[model samples]
Target: MEFWTGLYLMSFLNMACCLPKSSYTVYLNKLSFSTAQSHCLPGSFLANIPKEEEMAEILKTIWDKNDKTATSFWIGLQKNKGDCYRKDLPLKGFYWTVDSSTQSDVKLWETEPSNTCLELRCGLLSVKYGETAATCNGFVETTCRQEHPFICKRNATVTCRRPDILGTHDIIDYSNDKDTCYVHCASGANFTLKCSKDLVWTVLGNQNMDTSQLCLECNKGYRRDASGYCVDVNECEESKPCTHRCLNTDGSYKCACSDNDMDDCDGSKPPTTDLTRNDYSNVNRGKSLLTQPTSLPDDVRTNETDVHIEESVGDVSNIIVPVIIALLIFIVLLVIVAAIVKGCIRRRTTKLSRRKAEAVALNGSNSMEKVNEKEET
Candidate 1:
């Protein structure tokens, strides 16, 4: 009894799941950071072969119960380069649904793609050139799109670990000790035994961080879903569409208008204090009504909300635009400088804060001495 199930493929292990296709084909060659974020599973995905083996068993159950030929598909199994690695696709085309990772047909990726650093793709296959990373939506070449078999990946079944471990594991090779693996429990599970990368060890049972949830894709802006990867959160989308100025941060975003911020601490609209403290009260009134909520009756709201949203957003953008520009300029400058400085630059930046603190202490001591002399006189 094999019925066609919509396939939702994940281009990368730590990215979001691709939308379930009515009839779609994915031959991933290079999934970018955004791809990693976008196609990553909803919760967490197993990045280890052992875990994938568990996942494959579940797949086998479904295939065994169904009456259909196995489809050609891709699974994550690349060489263990200290970077992202994807393995080659097996000839029969192994899908994530296959349960046996140890099968002879399983392909493995080549180990050494880099000379000294981490800057390439891994898993099903390795991208030869260096990372020219792009956003999730960006399009690139893929392997031939010949139809083989289909892969069906539903959300990880509610961790069957209630009787066992209730979450997925984030395994990092112990940096200090290669033999051990530092595991972290994702899904926001409240396990607080932060083990050093060296101290972290995997277990068939007992104590360790339960990585129930895999790293999830951050929302657009601040965290963006690039072509087939997860990227810096795109603050552009998270900023309330109703606000005038939107700025993105590492984990969150903010919105503002000249002389007033529409953003609150939690990144939501502000309270009356924010409104009353606004100095641009008159300027705000005279400005176009871009920030106004457009939930009015559909007839009265004739103008496209998108256009209005743009208009409202345009004003506060003055401040943010300069900041954005400045940030970009700064980034460009940093890149150029970095290209020149390389390892030295990285080392200096690491130690810079300490230098600044030391300078501040010396200045404070001099100021205190001067104050004491003046008081004595």
Candidate 2:
């Protein structure tokens, strides 16, 4: 039994530690190769030219439906040899952005040699030319030229997640580790948050520790009061937000009503009045028509009656004003639509009448032409 239980627990823990989802997005803004690479900061780097099959997949993902024409794109392929005009010669090192792997078996270049300019050594990929080398700093406005849009590949291993902190609007940055995140605190201090690998966010700093090397002070359930000292939350000060009398304690507070009522206090209790229930009952006639009371109040039922009457008037006004405005708008739309339909009917009738008159005139001219031919014969 103990062996089976331990096995099940290990399986559960393994499932909980699955990898996060990965995503990649294309940017259309035209930028220089170096500048475009720098823009993919925080957690991503410039897209690296992948292996033959992988490059095809990446291009397929970024294939734009709106712009089907293949544009020039920058890839993470470059040679660092001082001599520029060497193609078959051994390169010092050709590497991807993150991984320093050599670009060997994947050959996707045109037949034309790339070193037309002595300074051209950067790699460019597109539909026409599978892969070609060019000057990294060259530029032109035309499509398929050196200056064009590029695709940036996201690092699949790294995932950025926002931290859950109260009263903080600062942006949180994610990293390779799932249990860690970078955030800015209320004191304008920037720090990396790392707890004991727990799911919940726990402040890992100690107050008694030295301040030189990243000290996190506050703990859960305690905050800096107005006097800048950490104090326990007060429950009885009505900030406990209890509806009735607040019972203060060391850690929390409890609420209880004098009449032993559990319902939320809506502050609608009636005030004392001289009139009896029957004398001023007629005043609440319109109000009771909407929401009838379930039971009777104890002391000042007359005051409660007036409160309901005012609420009914307010509700009726809110309903009536919107109905009137909607009716006016509907009438205006109906008039405009009717005018448009009438104009269309009038134009159609005029067109039919003109066609009939033209036909009659043609028949009359044909009869005259036949008479002239008979007279000549």
Candidate 3:
């Protein structure tokens, strides 16, 4: 009896561990690749056969289905936009739709009827020689617009199915070990779920707990209303984060300053200068102040230095204006003095010449008188 119980336990454990990781479902309904993908949404996705064994398994599954109309079935392999062909590489730039990181098995491609990646192409497994009775070979490239029967794949583990209690807005995340599923709602509420070995989902330590009680927390910039839905929180009315004017946005608030109070509205002080404070004593200060170490911040020091430079330029201009005026006055006075001295010299030379001429005439008159007296005697 003990041996029989041990054998039964071992068989159960072996069956549990040997369970397939995924399962495939073939849909004979002809549909485009996009439509087929859409049909597989919410839980499953397009089939991905990454290994030769998996491809063989899928082909065997298709053969077992015995669909007389399906000549080819769409797979998850597709050449996305901007993906060109590479003659040296396997799969020729095609990627699996479910997990692009998994490379397609190189042996799962046929050699005949070679195809090129000239356009957006999707992949499908074709029946050899177009015979429905024939087994499917490797995949072949075809346009995505072509209608064909498709295969969808989903996780086949004994784990619980993903819950949909939180509606379409809920995001589900799995742990690295894939033992725990975390459901996060847009309303900022979070719920924890675990799959037991018995194929049951336990929600927050209870198997049949009310999900409405899980949505208690609110997200940032949102608040729960009376209807239990998350609504936008008016930060302008509630928090008043703005200094001057507060404008409410969808999930945030904008702060604005008036034209006159443009400075310091964003919680930063305005740039200041000595001239703005009407302190002229430091107008002639030298660069020594800059060379010396100070306790002021770098930005403050930079602003003060720039202001000092501007004020120094203005002071230099003030001194230059007076100097220019004084030079002009001195030049005008020098010219007038030169002109007066030239006029006086000209007058003195004229008077000296007239006196000499007068002396000469008087001497001639006296000589004439002496001559007349001699003639009379």
Candidate 4:
């Protein structure tokens, strides 16, 4: 079934789970550097000062509780005494035995030692003073000399003896402090089991309790469903958790840049600039159309009708202005044609009249010439 349809049903479902804190062990034994190194074997090493403030604070507490004398136990630091041909300095050779690391950032020192001194080599921890150099063969007096006691730091260990169910593969986690509460054991291909704080091994999908338990959300990017199973939550549908688009993964969601065309990420209604004309296609116009009353009184109807009439009149004027222009152009063409025709007729008439007058004058001159000839005879 779709998860969204069941969202209302499981609206009160618990989402948070509890986790256990990491465990640490401290051993207080008086021994030489080599003896102390062997003492913290199999599981732990000499206490290596941690970088975290909380861990440092814990070590300080342990130190405060046990510190009664000037010389305390040796920590992870051991003296690096090399032969005469050794090119490396004494401080350079010094390293942590825990992981063979030479990283030394946070150092508690009573008085900083000068590398010029060859005898003082191994690291020693004093209750009131802090970390300082001491001789390996016990030479320096009143400070850190002779064989002294030391502290060893080890991580609390947890082991799963057997699988909660038969034919199931077990996944173990002893690394994280927060992940100490539950262990993941897979049944079949998809389903998993979680061991809760109550020491009860409950299979996922078997609903006997309502309270949240660690590893219930077994997968990292998934959420627990009503069936008490871990499932991916489609964050894009309900919460709209992304700036642009939300992509759901195993137990987490990722955001992406929005597509082009419009800058709005939520895919909301597009913007409108001209509001004078009613466009019912948009949300704003639809709201305006819905909010107004359907029926109107006689006077209101009259006013609306008058407004429509005015609009119609304006439309008519817009159409009439172009038609009038076309008609004026046609009339001017006709007048120009008529004037050209009249001018041609007037020129033809004048030419015909001139030709007739010339013919009559020629005929009268011929008759006069005939009379003159008869008188001469």
After superposition, the stretches of candidate 2 with alpha carbons farther than 4 Å from their true spots are: 1-23, 64-66, 79-83, 89-101, 111-113, 116-121, 128-146, 161-377
Q: List, residue by residue over 51-115, the lDDT tens digit for candidate 2.
A: 44456555555653245454566665554435343466322233555575655445545332344
TM-score of each: 0.17, 0.36, 0.37, 0.30
Q: Which ranking of candidates, highest lDDT first?
A: 3, 2, 4, 1
Return the TM-score for candidate 2, rounded to 2 decimals.
0.36
lDDT of 3 by residue, 99-175 (tens): 78436564456643244545788888876533554565677888899999998876554456565464434647664
lDDT of 1 by residue, 97-199 (tens): 2243533432342333333224323223222211332111111112322222222232333222221234454555534433334444453322222322222
Ranking by TM-score: 3, 2, 4, 1
- lDDT (C-alpha) at residue 66 in model 4: 52
lDDT of each candidate versus the true structure:
0.38, 0.52, 0.68, 0.50
lDDT of 4 by residue, 78-193 (tens): 54444121224322445566776755545445544434434545666554434532212221212224567666654334332333433334455445432233333342233344
Pairs that collide in candidate 3 are none
Model with the higher TM-score, candidate 2 or 4: 2
Candidate 3 is scored at a TM of: 0.37
TM-score of 4: 0.30
Which pairs clash inside model 2? none
